[model samples]
Target: MKILVVDDEPLARERLARMVERLDGHELVAQAANAEAALQLIEERDPDVVLLDIRMPGTDGLVAAEQIAERPNPPAVIFCTAFDEHALDAFGTSAVGYLLKPVKTEQLTQVLDKARRTNKLQRAELTDSAPAAGNGQRTYLSAKTHRGVDLIPIDNIRCLIADQKYVTVYHTEGEHLLDETLKDLEQEFAQQLVRIHRNALVAIAHIQGLERNAMGQCRVRLEGIDTAPVVSRRHTQSIRSLIQQL
Candidate 1:
């Protein structure tokens, strides 16, 4: 069976690649470090099996698998994540196989065989985290950092900017790579945040100004943040009206 291994950790990705090559009858077609690259390679290579990692810096593995499940004749997905606590989240996406890292070589072989026999994949809604925490208010967000998971207060957030396969949450403390989608954040923070661009959402209280450039294109200047978030033409009038209240 052809295989595609996706993991953000360089060592982890290389280890899987080496093992998959040694396994009988299976070929390691491609290796990707993030969800965005994985999706691109999956389309370009069309491997029969995708060995995915659940947690990553940008888009995360489950989100990528959910997208793979959308493609016609999508490849079989086998999650290889360190977070055993996310077992339920993995299966929630209709995955036929799941493995906790560090994955054993013999175990991988077994799952690949199962992939060959697995003919259908069921689809389900994939969510990055629980809808709410702390009395159902979702007052904080859990983000993974190099050291560990950091809990960021919702009130501290200034804006969210979409970058490649991930959306970065910009807050008072610092910036973070959020696993949540831009649309999801907009909906989740609807009362406090508003869309500034298709790729960005800014906090209403943090909104500084909506100014037009020499080109007549509107740009949103955020409070205490040097970078300006471009306001889309489609949302220009709406942002202008909101600026009046500010």
Candidate 2:
């Protein structure tokens, strides 16, 4: 995979560059000291992934990531920061990897491998269907799992259930926990998903049927999953209308 290293500190950039050289099947395409130069290089080089730093002279990495995401087929971003406090904010920008300063060779390799896999999957999806136009909404959700960062495709998600602070994403493969709030997810995927209850949002395309249980409580049946999420009375009529349309 082609790579770009972006950092304000010369020593830091050199360290990461050396690491990239040592890794097989990867090439260092360019280096930039700030977000401005990085963006320019991104257009010119079109690297597969970027190793970005948070603090810079101007246009911090976080903001730069948001801008990169707006571009069509943007390269994956892997943040290399010295602080852990920005971890949450980093993932919000659709970053696939987050590593602390003085990054280890093993960790960098792992993250890069994950990024390569994600890119391959995304390319396959594009070939299968017309790519969705960029609208600042994420096409995939990143989750930190035991293996590493898992990129869950938004279209494959069956539903999102909020228990408290974390939302559980039920997808085509299985379920995964996310740190995002349900409200934020609803806003982000409003067109593709619909709210069935206060704590749940089901994918609009996956809704198979709506039925009432023995006690007359409404529940929604979704394709590919046996567990039917309950439908609130307020949303029952809307769900019925949707079912009729289907």
Candidate 3:
């Protein structure tokens, strides 16, 4: 497996490099002293895994990991940090593993093995399955586009519409077909999304208002979206109450 070591400290970078040399079947592709440099190296080296540090001089590991997750076939992230406080946040960015500072060689080997075994989708699933704590939800939703992997930020999302088996994500930028079911997305983002209809889930923050057509059919107006999704009769009252609070 190809690997990149990203740390602000030179000694820490050297130590990790030496450890990678000791391990078999792995190559140290490059090293970066900051998150910005690491991102650049990722574009150039295209490593399979990155041993990242959480507390960097700029950008920080959490934000950097989100950016990395947006890439097509992004490398697995294994955070090597002195602080364990960012563990949940690390996993939220679809990180495959987390190792405390003064990382042991054995631990590094185990994590590398695990990363090598897991693919991008599997890593996201692992993060979804992790116990919810301290904003453990993913910052962006990944979808396979004709161009490549398209990452839609959760905050920019207006609504998710289900058409038969596929779910389409409507965000601020535009729409993209998601390789996910509406039911699964509803359950995963229950707190941030509201089930306006059996086939639709709208972001709670994007709910502009509820409207009734001339025929008394209810529809929901969402911020930044031209089309208003229909609201089921069963959920109309509930949506009204929700809007009252907002």
Instruction: Give lDDT per model, in order.
Output: 0.78, 0.83, 0.82
Clashing pairs in 1: none
Q: How accurate is candidate 2 locally (lDDT)?
A: 0.83
Better of 2 and 3 by lDDT: 2
Models 1 onward score TM values of 0.49, 0.62, 0.52
Candidate 2, residue 202: how far the Cα is off, in Å:
8.0
Candidate with more favorable, higher TM-score: 2 or 3: 2
- The best-first sequence of candidates by lDDT reads 2, 3, 1
Summarize candidate 2's per-residue lDDT along 38-145 as a digit string, tens digits. 999999999989899998888999988877766667787889999788777775555777898899999999899888888754332323322343775667776766
* Root-mean-square deviation of every model: 15.2, 6.3, 14.4
Q: Which candidate leads the pack in TM-score? A: 2
Query: lDDT (0-100) at residue 213 of candidate 2?
Result: 90
- Give the count of colliding residue pairs in each prediction: 0, 0, 0
